[model samples]
Every structure is written in C-alpha cells, then in structure tokens.
Target: MKITVVGAGAIGGFLACKLFAAGHDISVIARGATLHVIREQGLRLHTGNDLVIAPLRATSEPKELGIQDVVIFAVKAPALPAAVDAAKALIGQQTLVIPALNGLPWWYFLKSNSALSGTRLKAVDPDGMIERSVPTDAIIGCVVFPSCRVESPGVVRHMSGSKIVFGEPGGGSSSRISEVADVFLRAGFDAHAHENIREEIWLKLLGNACFNPVSLLVSCATDEMIDDPNLNTLFVEMMSELLELGNRLGISPKIDPLQRIAITRKLGKVKTSMLQDVEGHKHVEIEAILGALISVADLAGAPMARTRTVYALARMRAKTLGLLPE
Candidate 1:
C-alpha cells in the first residue's frame, strides 16, 4: 500500500526503514538537515543489533507525494497544528490519517463512544483547527508503545518495544484497521486492532503525564527520579488523580496505577520523550500530555488537583525554557 510518514524522526524513521525494506512504497515528509540526510543516504535504523537503510522518496513538500492510502503523523504535539496543511495534501478521500503521537490526541473523542465525544481539547487543538481540517471519517486512532530516539540526522535507534495499536473512532472492528495492523506486523511490530483504544491511551498516559514532566523539571532519568522518596510520593499522587479522572471519563484498564508504576520503574535509568525534548531544546508536548487531560477532567467534573499542580509546574518550566509561549 502507498504510505507517507509526516515526520521522519525517531518513531517515523523506525517504521519507515522497516516498511521500505518490506517493499512498501514509502514517502517521508521532512525538512532541513534531516530531510537532506534522508534524501541523500536514505533513512537509517539501528535496532540495537542490526542496521538497515531504507530508500524512500523524501521531500519537504507534501504535494510531491500525492494521495496515500495511509498517512502516519509522527510529529511532536506542539508542531501538529502547523502540520495540518501538509497532512491534508497526502490525505485522499479514502485515506487514513493515523496520528502516532504521545499523550492524549485532539482526535481522541472526535467520534468515540465516550461521553467526552465532541468535546474540544483546545490544549491539543486550539480553535478546533484539526477538526475543521481533517474529516472525522478519515481519522484512525493510533497508540504506540515503543521507545525510539533519533541518534543523528537520518539515524534512528530503537531501544525497545514495538506494540502499535490501531482503532477506528466509530468503534468496533473494521477491515481497514486489520489492513493497517497487517502492514505494521509486516514491519516487525506487535500490532493489534482495538475496539476501544482509549483505555490503552489512558493507561499509557498515567506514567507519561507524571514522569515525563517530572524528569524534565529535575533533569534526571526515570530511575533517579523514582528513587527519591519525594519524587515517588509525587508520582503516586499524580497517578491516583489520573485514575480518578480516567474512571470518570469511562476509561477502564485492568492494570492499576501502582502496577503501572512498577512496570515503568523496571525500565530503569531511561529518559522520557519530554526530557529528551528539553535537552534538545525542542518543543515539549505539555498540552498533549497534561493540558488535554486537564481539559477533559474539567469536562468530567473530576478533581485533578495533583495533576493540575504538575501541569502548572511543567507549563511554567516550558515557558521559562522558551518551549512554550510566554
């Protein structure tokens, strides 16, 4: 199937290399030095043991790729709004727009079964720009559980995990979702189709909403942050509030917060995506990870005092670092 990756960083490069090697027609929309490197040498993937280079059509202009069967947007949250026009260029009438992003997405509640459906998370999509630009029918909800990083321009390092879940907003199973999962499976991902991916989204958010910002603020890795008594206590409080808010929002996950935290602590000495952003001086996903949750919590009439505290602190830090508007 014809596919286009909107961003060629980290997750995007990982999937692109695998998919391209698998003989799929892959096109990457990238810019500047990264684009130049990929265009000249192809995208490179180092899966810890194996190094693979994928020959792909790389261009900063989305129109060059034309319509695609699937357009995977792997952009950072803050850059998503500006990415709309490019994303639209590759989206045909029957195309699928899968946003493989962190935290909560703007399309989360677009047409879901949740009571939160139709409610706008302005934190993620200010003024409903995404809603207006991308049609609801074309949106396919995606949640990724992999840990990937860009080692350098055109070089992606896959640390671990490869579970990518896809779900249609209208609920239930669809042949289109199965097809998408098949492509991921072919690319060596543990892919699954979910009737309700929101549950998985919430489960993942439990750790990210807390740990990512905390790590950025303290300039520490996950192990060092969780090792501190004060940090551990704060983490528990944040998870508890998220659980409360998630339940109110109809997100039911079998795993509890403590179990989730235990799983994360096991990873040890890892830097979160947000911390990576801070170190790279790139825009952090504050609104996508925390601001969106706060908006939903308010909609659910759920108390999120602890979560709100973290959000406020993180936003301040982001502004101070020039990661967010003053």
Candidate 2:
C-alpha cells in the first residue's frame, strides 16, 4: 500500500523504515537536518540487534509527495494543527489519516454516543482545524505502544514495545480498521483492531496523566515517581480524580488506580517522554495529556482538584525553567 509518514522522528521514522522494508511504497515527511540526512543516506533503523538501512522518499514538502493511501501522523500534540495542515497535501479522496499520537487524541469524541458526542476539545483541537482539514469519516484512531527515540538524524532506535492499537472512533469494527491493522502486522509489529478503544485510550491516558507530568516535575524516572512514597501518594490521588472522571464519562478503566501505580513502579527508572522533552528544552505534552483530562472532567461535572493541583505545579515548574509558555 502507498503510505506517507509525517514528522519522521523516532516512531514516524521507525514505522516508515519497517513498512518500507516490507515492500510498501513509503515516503517520509521530515525537515532540516533530518530531512537532509534521510534524503542523502536514506533511513537508518537500529532495532537493538539489527540495523536496517533503506532508501526512502524523504521530503521536506508534503505537497511534493502527493496524496497517499494512508498518512500516519506521529507529531507531538502541541504540534497538531500544524501537523494536520501539513498533512493536507497527502489527503486523497480515500486517504486514511491515522494519528499515532500520545495522550487524549483530538478525534476522541468525533463519533461518540454520549451527550458530549461531536464536542470538540479546545485544549487539543483548539480551532477544529484537524477535524475540518481531514474528513472525520476517514480518520482511524491509533494508539502507539512502541517506545523509540531518534538516535540521530535519519537514524532511530527502537526502545521497547511493538504494538499499535487501532479502532474506529465510533466503536465500529469495520473492515477498513482491519486492513490498516494488517498493514502494520504484515510489517512485523504487533497490531490489532480493538472493539471498545475508548477504554484502551483511557487506560493509556491514565499512565500518561499520572507518570508523565509527575516525572517531569519531580525530575525522576517512572519507577522513581511511582516508588517514592510521597510522589506515589500524589500520583494515586491524581489518578483517583481521573478515574472518577472516567466513571462519569461511562468508560470503565481496565486497570485499578493502585494497580496502575504498581505497574509503573515495576517499569523501573524509565524516564518519561515528557521528562525527556523537558530535559531537551522542548515543549512537553502537558495540554493534551493532562490539560485535556482536566477539561473533560469539567465538561462532565467531575471535580479535579488533585489533577489541577498537580498540573499547576508542573506547569509552574516548567514555566520557571522557560520550558513552557505560561
């Protein structure tokens, strides 16, 4: 199948490489040094034991690549509007936009059956550009479980996990979702179409809501954030508020709050992507991961004192260090 991967950083580059190796017509949308490197030396993937180097159609301009059968968006949440706008050139009449992003995705409530159905999240979508730029009916919700980091320009290291969870936003198990899943599975990663993906989305958000910001604030790893007595207590309270919000939204989280904390603790000293972004002097994904939850809680009439407090503290800390803007 014809595919284009925008943002070509870590996950994007990794997917592009694997899919390219699997005989898909893959193109990468990258920029600056990364674009130069990929265009010069193709793309390089370091998968622990093996290194796969393959020539790729790397370009800085999305319009240059033309429309594709599928567009896998892997840009950060704060960069969503720009990402969506940039992806427009690749949207054909039948193109599927699969957003492999973190935290609460912008398309979360597009086709929901709740009272909040069709509600657009300002924290995530802001102006509904993503919703408008791409047809909602062509959107395929994707939750990435792989851990990877850009080793350097044109080179990415696969850290852990290979699963990519996907489902229709409206809870429909269509053949299209399965076809997309098959594409990834045939490329060698674990891919599956979920029945009730809302639960899965929340379950993943629970991890990000508790672990990511707290790790950034405390300057600790995942295990440290979960194992530290005082920090772990704070994490539990924040999760409780989130769980309560989930209950109000009619989505039951598969993992209990305490058990979730335990799992994080066992993950052991892994620095969260948010903390890493802070360390790199880059914008962290606070708004999508935490801010969106807080907004949703308010929309659902759920109290979020603990979540607000934690979010405020983290933002303040980041602001003080010039890591975030207000």
Name the best candidate (by lDDT): 1
RMSD (CA, Å), each prediction: 1.3, 1.5
**Candidate 1 lDDT over residue span 1-326, tens digit each:** 89998899998898888888888999998999999999889899999689998878999999878889988888998888878866788888998989888989887887777677777788888889888888889988888888888889899998878889988876788998898898889878899999888887888898899999888789998889888989988898889888888777777778776788888888767789999899898989988899888888888888788889888998999999999832
Score residue 276 of candidate 1 by CA lDDT. Answer: 89
CA deviation > 4 Å runs, candidate 2: none
326, model 2: CA deviation in Å? 7.6
Backbone atom clashes (below 3 Å) for every candidate: 0, 0
State in Å the error of residue 22, model 1. 1.6
Instruction: Report the error of model 2 at residue 155, Å.
Output: 1.9
Cand. 1 Cα-lDDT: 0.86
TM-score of each: 0.97, 0.95
